[model samples]
Target: MSTVGFVMLCHTALDRAAQVARHWAEQDCPVVIHLDRRVDKASSEKLRSDLKDCGNIRFSKRHRCEWGTWSLVAASQTASEVMLAEFPDVRHIYLASGSCLPLRPVDELREYLKARPRTDFIESVTTQDVDWTVGGLNAERFQLRFPFSWKRNRLLFDRYVELQRRVGFTRKIPENLVPHLGSQWWCLTRQTLSAILQDPARKIHDAYFKRVWIPDESYYQTIARLYSTRIESRSLTLSKFDFQGKPHVFYDDHLHLLRRSDCFVARKAWPQADRLYETFLGPNHRESQMAEPAPGKIDRVFAKALERRTRGRAGLYMHSRFPRLDLENGKTCARYSVFQGFNDLFEDFEPWLSRRLGTRVHGSLFDPVRARFAGDADIYAGCLPATAALRDDNPEMFLTSLIWNTRGERQVFQFSPRDNQRICWFLSTDSNAQISVITGAWAVPLYLSNRDFSDIRKEAALMQKREVEFVNRLRNIGTRADVRVWSLAEFIEEPMENLQSILDAMDGPSAPRLTEAPRMANLDGFGQFLQNLKNQGMKPFVMGDFPATNVEMHQPTGGPRPYLVKK
Candidate 1:
């Protein structure tokens, strides 16, 4: 039976490239790769050698692909040509990148393609579509000449482009050519590919597009529309583009969405996010075949733990001291919250926790700067920074710190009083490093500017040391009180097992029966909070809020207190 062909456009991460090749190869699909010409000769040779064992892999002619240039289109053309020539039995070709991963199993994908042998999966939009301008790219993309590469001279490039606009010089579309723009990734049948390559007007189309901006997004899509009569206006790959029209990098947190997307492929995954790849494609990925455990079981475990701890109190008071059980009307409640590094807060975690715990947890979007506490029976749950300088004098407080080193930076910590119970959650080193760059950028933006490779390496070393120091301080405090540590990665990988472990750590009864589904959280309120933050030009940070100061008060120890506002 004829199968699908893959044309992968890859630049770096040779190891990941090899894994992708192996994945498709196992499914009996042929793969043609066009590696960036900028890669060193040795690296290119090593990659080729690595894939030598994969019988169906082939290398295409090298091309130096500059951003927003015709070189990218040239590289795609080369890969498609090789696939068509070498894989004569291929019924369809799927264009993807080295970072793209198959979301569905190969067997299922093959069955889907076999059922719809003639349909093409390509995202195409005529130039007149409103969405074509969503990225703020103007009509000049098809009107002006971008002959010379401007990747290095962005300032001059902008000036030249503006100059062209002022001069009113424009290039007319060819007699019969209609402009279209869409995502660069697509899937097309062999007949459609052959027709595009063999079209008599191919040279003229190429000549016009050679000077057009980002021709890769338009060239194939336009040609595919002209040649293929049965085209589906959507790519089989799932991707999320930012305001700048750049794809959002995938991480382990995105695994749930990827599994549920029902798309065959997802793209723009980074090499550092190997955990995400492993979760979907590794040996242990088979676990995904099983059903997720009921959230009610986990909630009962939490409620039992709370009941034990709050025997004398009306409510489970987390991170608060001084029992006010008599003040309450005699209602008991369970309180649960997660506190972690600023960038480590996953959007789904808060809502998931709320749904599982049968309560509307405050979540990360809630403003922690004000530190407002609800009434005696009310639950206050949210992610907040634990500052070393701030101390809760109350002896009955319970503190839980979810420690995941997304950024290798130090977290400010204070040893809880001997009477207070503390729990420290830590992630494995591999999981910690998965989103280090992402968290580092958000937490310590000052360190990311204009640094060379060597400087970056040195900074990374410093960050690692800081992280180690922070963890050690937490361990020292563990010796003094009821301190418990839990592995976050274990919980994420095996939710049911780790949920039980967490309950055990809390001294809860074993194996509680499942209860009714918990109510959903106030997601609309969370959304509004996020919008308010954006409106105020603020974002979550590891440093917490800036120290408050009274401009009118005189300091006996210092000349003046610095009035710094949180950014």
Candidate 2:
């Protein structure tokens, strides 16, 4: 297998950039660095001096990076071309940043890719008919001179980056051409790299991108899709992001979600996120190596990530391409309509979510302000406290909604051995004669439109009769328990001063039978009511009473209680 070339782009991360460089050095990959041009001479000298001991590290002259500008791509293009010029034998070139940490052990990634050398890791995403996510669509400002602009002049940079600051880049979509999306950082084959660097037709792809949209974020992904004949995987990393639209925010709570994303890298972190980053880099992350599942697993993981993004029809802010799913031959893909009013930062993210929400539930990427999928998407259900509820209260729904269902076996709804509940059925608008159903993982975007009302709520009569029946379903198996519905309004109707009462009701150790299951009815009121208490400083998993949603371990009203607890 040929050696890999790592092209790292850096800006303000002086103190830690060298450590990242050292890590790549240890991986034995060729290293190429491009420090941002605007970096001060003193800082640049210090960084170069600090990294002097790493014989393999090569530094490029710093180029400035404007927050929302595309000038930065000029530096990257220059560096990429330079790297290829010097080391033409390198099999692959990967784009990364000073802050990004490799999720896989370098050897693991190398071995995984060594076997399949033709696929390009870039994603070619399409949502051409969609509008800019910001609101109004403008292509002139959205596309740029250099692809990424380093704030050449702070005033001009401010003016350039301002619109995107208030409104995100996704707010605009170009006509005719679907926005080809992928990772800004991708592992490109030497063939693709050479195509990008040596092609006589580069100007066509380049000039078109200079006027299209999201210049830097879209450049690489689009060019590859337009020119390169082969594509490997679409996703380079999974990211966490926020309103300012710069990067994803990293915090202590995001730990578990990171584990499940199965991506090679995640970013938009604060300096404080360093400690958490180390955990993945440490020797113990559960996913560090997946038992070396058959060679195709890693590629499948990457493709699936891109597929999920495409399925949701969400806009990608990067510049790589994905393998076309529909085309199958690596040349075509599914297309989605990209409209800006379709996305809103505040609407998508619940204000309460940032502080203490369920860490288990995946965040929403759909346009929130438009409320297009308000009735559909899973917004707040997967909080930390809902784990048992997910496993016990509605295991059937959970199993149908989450477990991978490609196995094709009948998924049982109850203890019965023969129930084909894995399938979700729904009705379409073809004059009420339209019937639609699907069977697959009910995760995120899949469960919504993928299933119909009939599919999701299959037992119509039983489901419609009353909330109590729904509540009873939450009881432990064979336990005759009466269930009641609770709403956030009813819970929060109590004065804030009485917040302790709610928590007092919820806090306790109950009977063994209670441990077998939980009551999962309309807990909306209950959760809504808890918001006030939560705002009052009642911890999410408060061990004692202060502000809690009320749920008690109940025994039959006619019979003795399961057990009483000491306060």
Candidate 3:
């Protein structure tokens, strides 16, 4: 049984904690919550009362907290210390804030943890002395008196931080000890947490950390560097930050942006951010509070699995029956396949696809294509959780979902294609490490820039127009060979854009900075041939035994599907 400890360190987040407590409790997972020192007992007690039914919940007493100060260290240490004592069985500790919400299901999160016993989720950020481990606190002030500490002095703290910024004295990682900085929010393994909590070398290292201006962040980085193996050095936290180096206040404008990142949680949203929180979570607007995913949610889950795999952002739960094309196809000739980049086309795609042999299929063997909105790094980032819902309960379906990330990797949401049975495709943004996808036919999104039309509402009009173009393209392409064009969107919508509601079938659910496209091609859609093959029960047939032509997959009688080779 895996456990998650949500470490809340602010009074402003008490009510949020109650909601989270109720959430995980219903999931039947254990939760350990703590209040910061300044949080009054009245609020804490009230929170405890509201969440009293939440089993396996424990609240801490020796709270040590001070905003923008090293006291945060004391608070985290105190909470973690107590957490270790109370829950010796906890395999992992996810230090989260009350404002953060789980984007993926709870079971998914736990499953991810169960696989990686050696890997730690805590990003060991590297910094010399003054570093970025949530760097608002200074180590020298750890035991300093409130009235005497310089960081405690509002005027001096600001001046000192600003001065440090002007001097441009960025942190350094000596060859012997490299430093990194990131969010304090972490998903840590027990071993890593234990080492930090009970370091025998703390006495020796403490003196050095004490000399640094802000050791709260550096202390962990230094210790982890000296200790843990290959810290990804990222807190996996993506809360919007302000110019002054503080968490930006999240508002309705930020709601959709947060979803696209495919991240498990986001942070620093204001208390009033409730409106956005309630309205836009990748799925339904209304919170279910249900123990199980509602009906037809399984398809959505499969769509996510497919999208993650395509993007290569698939985390621990990546399992696919798709045969390997790289080794046999001589993909080793290239370090990174050119196909690994982004491609986008707007018109003339429908007819092209109807001729392709890739999109055809009927019955159980015929898989419907569901599109996922991806691309445009300017839109948002995407990352998968450690674990996922069991495949048995969340079976994969052809028509899954399309996720959109506008605001250049900030907000994201899952969308259903109008034609789930027709076809689907993925595309990429021009160089600059962004991704974008066209679902069916969308009448050129206004601006097509990263700025406007950031909301999902903009999708309504394009959806209607594309559906018509889809069916026309399919019928037209099957009979014509002269047509040579491919729009990623039109291909997916052809046959019948409004064939079926894709989102109605969804169940649930990032990638890096990729560069642009320098080449362009006028290609043909292969759907027409694929459809005929599907009508044949997806049997193996060689198109033409020519190079770079139709791929022939061998199938023996009463045997399994065989290897695919280009004829």
Over the full model, what C-alpha lDDT does candidate 1 score relative to the true structure?
A: 0.57
Query: What total of clashing residue pairs does each candidate reach?
Result: 0, 53, 65
Q: Evaluate model 3: give its TM-score.
A: 0.43
Error in Å for residue 219 of model 2:
1.2
lDDT of 1 by residue, 12-78 (tens): 8888988988888877999999999999999999999988898899999999988889999899889
Model 3, which residues run further than 4 Å from truth?
128-151, 155-180, 206-211, 279-567
Query: Per-residue lDDT of 1-567 in model 3, one digit per residue for the tens?
Result: 555555555556677667766676666556666676566778867888987776677776655555544566666666777767877777777777777766556665666666665566665533344443344554323323233245457786656556656775444323344444446777676678779778876665555444444455555655666666546555544554433456655667655555555455567666676675565332453333422212133335434644544444311122443324321211111111011001222222222222221221111111123122232122112332112122112222111110121121221122223333232221111011111223322322221324333232344343544433433443352322111222443333231221111111111112211121122222232333333333544321211111223322223256442221221
The Cα RMSD in angstroms, rounded to one decimal, for candidate 2 relative to the true structure is 22.9
Evaluated at residue 363, the lDDT of candidate 3 is 15
Against the true structure, what is every candidate's RMSD? 23.5, 22.9, 22.8
Q: What does candidate 2's lDDT look like per residue over 1-567, in tens digits?
A: 336778888886666667667777766777788988788889989988987887777887556765444555667787887778777667878888777756566676676667657767875565453342342333434343323333346465455556655665433333334456545768788888777667676665555665443566667766676456678546555553332234555555666555555555555445566765677656564444543323233335445644654443221212353324232221101111111110110123222222222122122212122112223343322221223333344333333233222122211111110122121111010111111111111111211234553443333222223222322343335322122222223322331212223222222233122211111222223333334434554322211132234444233356543332312
Is candidate 1 or 2 superior in lDDT? Answer: 1
Candidate 2: worst-modelled 10 consecutive residues by lDDT = 426-435
Better of 1 and 3 by lDDT: 1
lDDT at 393 for candidate 1? 30
The most accurate candidate by lDDT is 1
